[model samples]
Target: MSKTISFVLNGRQRSVQVDDPEMPLLYALRNDLGLHGPRFGCGLAQCGACTVHVEGKAVRSCTFPVAQAAGAKLLTLEGLGTPERPHALQKAFIEEQAVQCGYCI
Candidate 1:
């Protein structure tokens, strides 16, 4: 059975129905909420592509259980900034042209 998991997503309070509490937060963010910022790299969490900010700290969403995020705040790449006012790192990356495929951007 699916259970509702409530959390703050990019500063907005949101809830998602998770069938398995052990389900990765990546799935909830992508399949459920339709977010594309976090890439699905190595499903084993060995790669850094599935990184997301949880309560201001980086966490591997691919292997992170959705239940563990209840009531916590989450931030994805898209939440980092906007085109009009990109984040410092974002601006630096653009200036340096240090991005390709954007899997870990």
Candidate 2:
């Protein structure tokens, strides 16, 4: 059954029709919705690369099912900062030069 689930993504109200309840939110965000900030690293939820804020708490998007994200506010890397105005963490990362290779900051 293709069910439509609505949620707040990057501070924007968005919805997606999904058939499987076990489909991870990461795939839905990247493939379906086109939000690609979070990278895929260890789909088993071992890596922190797929970190995203779900209702003010960091969560592993790789394992987070889209069904669970329904009606919840999701803040990915895109939402935390922007090109014009970056977040404090982003600014700190730039200042400290903390990124090494594709760190998915």
Candidate 3:
């Protein structure tokens, strides 16, 4: 059965229909919401590539259940800032030349 999961994404209200509530939140964010900020690194959640903020805490979206994120606030990299005005961390990274492959930023 398809279940509707609602959450605050990037300061906007959003909802997605998930067949399995246990499905990873990353799939909903990436495939359903069309967000490319989070990447699937290690499915084991050892890597922090799929890290996203939920309820003001960092979480590995790869293993996080979409159901658990219902009615919660989610913040992805895209929510940080725009190209015209980058976030402080993003600006610092560019100034310090910390960006490399841009995979695990």
User: Which numbered prediction scores highest in TM-score against the true structure?
Assistant: 3
Error of 3 at 102 (Å): 4.7
In terms of lDDT, the best-performing candidate is: 3
Candidate 2's displacement at residue 90, Å, is 0.8
- Runs of candidate 2 exceeding 4 Å displacement: 103-105
Candidate 1, residues 6-92, lDDT tens digits: the string is 999998899999779999999999999999889898898888888999999999999999999999999998788899999998999
Q: Let me know the TM-score candidate 2 reaches against the reference structure.
A: 0.91
Error of 2 at 63 (Å): 1.1
Q: Give the per-residue lDDT of model 3 (tens digit) for 1-105.
A: 999999999999999999999999999999999999998999778888999999999999999999999999999999999999999999999999895686564
Q: Count the clashes in each prediction.
A: 0, 0, 0
Q: After aligning candidate 1 to the native by TM-score, how far in Å is the CA of 36 from where it should be? A: 0.7
Root-mean-square deviation of each candidate, in angstroms?
A: 1.8, 1.6, 1.5
lDDT, candidates in the order shown: 0.92, 0.88, 0.95
Which scores greater on lDDT, model 1 or model 3? 3
Candidate numbers sorted by lDDT from highest down: 3, 1, 2
Superposed by TM-score, candidate 2 places the C-alpha of residue 38 at a distance from the truth, in angstroms, of 1.1
